[model samples]
Target: MASFATRHIARGTTIRASDCGSLADRGSSLKVEALLGATDQQLRTSGIDYTITAPSFFMQNFISFFTDDYKSGTIYQPVGEEKIGWVDVRDIAAVNAEVLLNPGRYKGRELTITGGESLSYTEAIAIMNERLGATTQFVSITDEAAVEAVSAAQFPEFIIDVMISLNHSIRQGHAEKTTNTVQEVTGRPPITFRQFVDDHRTTWL
Candidate 1:
C-alpha cells in the first residue's frame, strides 16, 4: 500500500503507525513520496518506490480552517504583500487521483499544481468578498501576534509554530509561482479562486 506524507516530515523517518491510522502504515512495503510538499531531495531519500509531489497551498483553507475569520469579516494572518498560487482542493484531488491510478506515469515526478493566477491575501479577499457579496477584509498580523492568537485559541504549540511558519513562507513569496500541472494531469484547467468562491458560496455565507 502507498501513503501520503507532508513536506515538513523529516526524510528517512519511519512511517508512524498512528499517523493516518493503521491502514496507512505498510511498513517497508508502503510507498511514499511527495505526498504534500516534499522536495525532490526529500522524496529521493524517502525510500519509497513511487513518488509524487504536490506543491501549493489549498484555497479551501478559507472555508475549512479560516471560516471564522472569513465570516467575521477579517482574515488575520502574517502573509503580507506577497502573492500565493492557491490551488483549489478539487483540482488537487483530481491530480492526486490521476497520480494514484497511473502510478508509473506519475512516479518520480513533482507536480506543482496551482490556480490560474497568483494573488495576495488582499487580492484574494477582494475576489472572495466580491463573489460572495460580503465585505470580508484581510488583516496582516505580525508573526508573534498570530502565534499568540493561535495559542489563545487552544491550539497546540507545535501547530501554532507551523501556522506561523506557513504564513512566513507565504509572506516571503515562497508560493508566488503558478503551474499548469493540474491541467496537464487532469486534462482540464484548474478552478480559479473566484470560481472556487462561487461554487462554495453557501459555505462562505
Candidate 2:
C-alpha cells in the first residue's frame, strides 16, 4: 500500500508489487512480522512505504499457525464465513508494474487488488482439487478441538485459539471482493483461478 504511495506518492517514481502471493490481510500481522524479520539490507532494497494496505477481511492465507498444525495431517485455514478480497501475486505485480511505468496514468492513489473472486476456505480448497489436482486434505476442526489438539504441542493454547478465530472470520465473509481494482489499473481483465492452475499446476503435480 505504502509502496504504491511512496513511488507514486512522494518520489514521483514508478512503483510495483511484482507479486502479491505472499501478501496477507492487515490483521494477519504475519506479513508484518516477516517484513520486520527481514535484514536491514532487505528493507533498504525494498524501500519503505508510508502506509500499508489494510483489508476489511484480509484473507491472504489461513496458515499463520504454529508447529502443531502440521501434525493434524490437515491445516485448518484461519478464515471464517467471510468473502474477503484475495489478489494473486501475478495480477498485483502486473498491475503495479504497468501503473508505475505509466505513472502519469496511475499515481498517488490507493488501489484495491484481488484475484477478482472472493473464495471461502471450502470453496478455495475445492477449486484446488478440481483445477489443480491438489487434494485440500482438510476437515473442519472446531476451535475447541484445535485448542485441544495443540495443547500438547510446543505452542501456547492462546495462540492456537487466535489462529482458529482468524479462520472463523473468513468463513463469515468479513473479506469482501472488488475485482475492478485490478481491471481499473491494468485496463485488462484479471486472471481466474483456472488460468492460475493451468499455468502452475505442473509444478505441484
Candidate 3:
C-alpha cells in the first residue's frame, strides 16, 4: 500500500464497486468519482492506477457539486494556466495491458499519466476555434470579487467559493507542470492538448 500525488495528475482507472454503498465510495454521485489521491489503506484492498488529478469545475460538476457559472455557457473555460492530466480511457487500458504482460515493472509502484501538455482551458478553446471554426463566446472573469458578485445572486450556496477557488489555482500555475510519464513508460512522446481537442472538438458545443 503506497501512495503518490502531484498537484492534479491524471488518474485513468474506473470503479470496481458497482453495487456497494460504503465509505469506499464516498463521493457526490451514484457512480464512483475518481479520487486522484487514494490513501495507502484504501490502496491495500484494491488494484489501482494512481495519479493526482487537479481539482476543477469539471470534476465538481461530474460529482454533482458545481455551480452553473463553471458550465460550458457561462464561463466556458478555465481562467488561467490550468493543465489537466487526463488519462484517455484507451491509453490507460493500454498501459494496464503492458503491466499485465510484464507484472514485475508495475506490480507495486505508482506512475504518472498525462494528457500531454499543460494548456489553459481558454487556450484549448482557442485551439478549437482555430481548427473547428467555433464561435461560442468566452467571457473572462478576472477576480474572486467579480466571481462572487456575479455568483451571489444566482449560484447555489455550495459552489460560490469552490468554483471561484479553481481560478486561483489556475492563475497561480498550480496546474502548469507536465510530467513525462507517458513517454517514460511507453517510449514515445505524449500527444498534445490540440490533438485531443481536435479529435473531440465536435463535442465542444
Candidate 4:
C-alpha cells in the first residue's frame, strides 16, 4: 500500500487526494485519510513537505469509464438535480506539475481545484448534444438501484459503497461548488466542461 510506504519515505513532498466541498464529501475523505494518514503523519514527522488536492468529478469520466453508456446517449447515475463542478483532468495535472517542480512554494497547502463552472448532468449532456451533435442523455437512477447495479458486476463491497455514497452526495448537492484554485495556481482559467467535450468530440463520434 502507498500509505504504508509513506512511513519509509525520508524526504520529498507528498500529494494527498482530498474531495471537493459537498454533502457527499465527508464519507470518502475519511476513507481516503485512513489509507493516507500514515503517510501524512510520517511526512510530518520527517519534516517532509506535503499538499492535498481536492478535485470534483472529472470531466473525462464520460470518455474514460462511461463510454459504453455514452454510446447509447445515456449518462446513468444517481445524481439528481444537483449541479456538479466537473473538472478537467488536464488542469489537475498542470497544478500537480507546478507543485512538483516547486514543492517548497506550496508546502503544507491544501488546494480545492475545479473547472470553474457547475452544471447538472442534464445541462452537461445538453451541451454535449449541441456541440457534438449527439443526443446524449442523463438517465438518473435511484441510489439503491445504482448501487445494486455496480454490485452485480462483482465489484468489491467497499468500492460499491463508496460509489453509492458519492452519488448520494451529488444528489445532496455536495459537488455543486466551484473554486478559482486552478486559475490562481496555474495563472490561467481551468478548462470548461464544454471545452473538454469539444476537444474530445471524436471520442464519442
Candidate 5:
C-alpha cells in the first residue's frame, strides 16, 4: 500500500515518505518495519529526489493508546524497563515541513528523529504524575496480555500485532537511541517528555 502510493507520487515531484526509526539499523524483522524498509529501498533506487523522515515512538501515544489506562492509574505494556526516545508528532511534522520546503537540500537523505531524551515507561509516568498531579503507574505485561488488552479495546488484529512487535523492539533497546536530527533540521530541540506532559496536562486531568 505505502510502496504503491510512493511509486506514483515519485513520478514527477519530489517525495517524502514517513517511516520508523528502526530502519536506521536495517535489523528489524517486524512485518510493518520490513515493509517500510522495502519502500525506502525503492525510493533510494528510483533515482528520484526523496526525503524520509523516520521518527521514533510517538509521544502522543499517551493520549491515544494509554489514556484509558492512565485514567485507571496504570500504563500496561509489554516493554519492561526499556527506555524509548519518544518523539512528538509535532516535531516530526516540523521536520517534514522543513524537508518539503528545501527538497533539494535533503534530497536522498533519510533523517531519523527522536526526542532529546530516552525514558522508560516508569520514568515517563513519573513525569506525568508529577506534572499532572495524578498517580499513574507503569505495569509490565506479557506480550500476550498486551495483545489481549488491545484486542478487548477493539483494535484491529494487524495493529495489535504491530504494537506487540514494537514493544518487543523497545524491550531490546532498539528505540532507546536519541539523535539531534530534530534540532539539526528544524533549528530547535525536540520536545522533551516533561514538556509534552506539561503541555497536555489537561488530557490527564
Candidate 6:
C-alpha cells in the first residue's frame, strides 16, 4: 500500500488525534482554515493510509518578511509578546520524508512539527542581533496598522484578512507550544531559532 504525507500551516495550534475535531470548527470563520479542515476530513475517510504534518510558523519569515526592516535596524509586527514555535522548513521536510519512506509506521497520524523552543518576536530578534552582531530592534505595531501596511502592499483582501486572523490567534498565545515530533520522527532535534539565524547570517548582512 502506498502512503501519502501532506503539510499544512497549522497557524498556532498543534494537531493531535484529539484536535482534529476542532479544525472544522475553526474553519467556520477562516477560509484557509476551512479548506485545510476539509482536506483533512477527506484524507481521513479516503481509506488510504495518510499522514498530515501540521507545522507552526516558519523561521524563514525573518528572511522573507523582516529582512528589509532588519536592514533598517527595526522590525515591526503585530504580535506583541506572543511566543511562537517556529519550525524550519527543512525539518518539516525531514519529517515528511521519514513518513513517506515508512508509510505503514505513521499511518493515520497527524504530527505537529515545531521548533525546539518557543520565542516571542522580541526575544527572537535579540537572538538575531547577538548572533549576527547587528543591533536591530523589534517594534510592536497595532493590528490596524498591520492591516494597513499589508493593504498598502496590495495584498488580496482575503489574504490580508486571513493573515490578520492568524496574527490574532498568535496574539492569543495559540502558537507558543513546542513539539518533539521532529526528533521523534527523524531521530534528530529540530533546528533552534538561534542556529537558524546563525546559518542565515549573510542574508541579514
Candidate of highest TM-score: 5
The sequence of per-residue lDDT tens digits that candidate 3 reaches over residues 19-78 is 321122234232223232243336534555433222122322211322233234434434
Give TM per candidate.
Answer: 0.78, 0.54, 0.51, 0.80, 0.86, 0.85
lDDT of each: 0.67, 0.48, 0.45, 0.71, 0.76, 0.77
Report the lDDT tens digits of candidate 5 across residue range 3-52: 54332211111111223333533335665555566677776778666877
- lDDT (tens digit, per residue) of candidate 6 on 88-198: 988988888887778778876778888999899999999998988889988889999999999999999989987877776677666777888899998899999988988
Model 1 weakest 10-residue run by lDDT: 14-23
Local error of candidate 5 at residue 114 (angstroms): 0.4
Which lDDT tens digits does candidate 4 get at residues 1-205? 3553331221222222334362212223544333444554555556555666667788998788777777786888888878888889899888888877777778777676777889998998888888878877888888788877888899999887666656665666667788888888899999988889889989888
Give candidate 3 regions above 4 Å deviation: 1-38, 41-87, 140-172
Cα RMSD of predicted structure 6: 4.7
Better of 3 and 5 by lDDT: 5
Alpha carbon deviation, residue 25, candidate 2 (Å): 11
Ranking by lDDT: 6, 5, 4, 1, 2, 3
lDDT of 1 by residue, 74-153 (tens): 99888888888888878877877877777777656655667889999899999988888889888888888887887888
The regions of model 2 sitting more than 4 angstroms off are 1-73, 132-137, 142-172
Model 4 residue 27 lDDT score = 23
Number of clashes in model 5? 0
Task: State in Å the error of residue 139, model 4.
Answer: 2.0
Q: Would you give me the overall lDDT of model 6?
A: 0.77
Rank the candidate models, highest TM-score first.
5, 6, 4, 1, 2, 3
Identify the candidate with maximal lDDT. 6
lDDT at position 128, candidate 6: 92
Q: Output the worst ten-in-a-row residue range by lDDT, candidate 2.
A: 9-18
* Clash counts for all predictions: 0, 27, 3, 2, 0, 0
**4 or 5: which has the higher lDDT?**
5
Can you list the residue pairs that collide in candidate 6? none
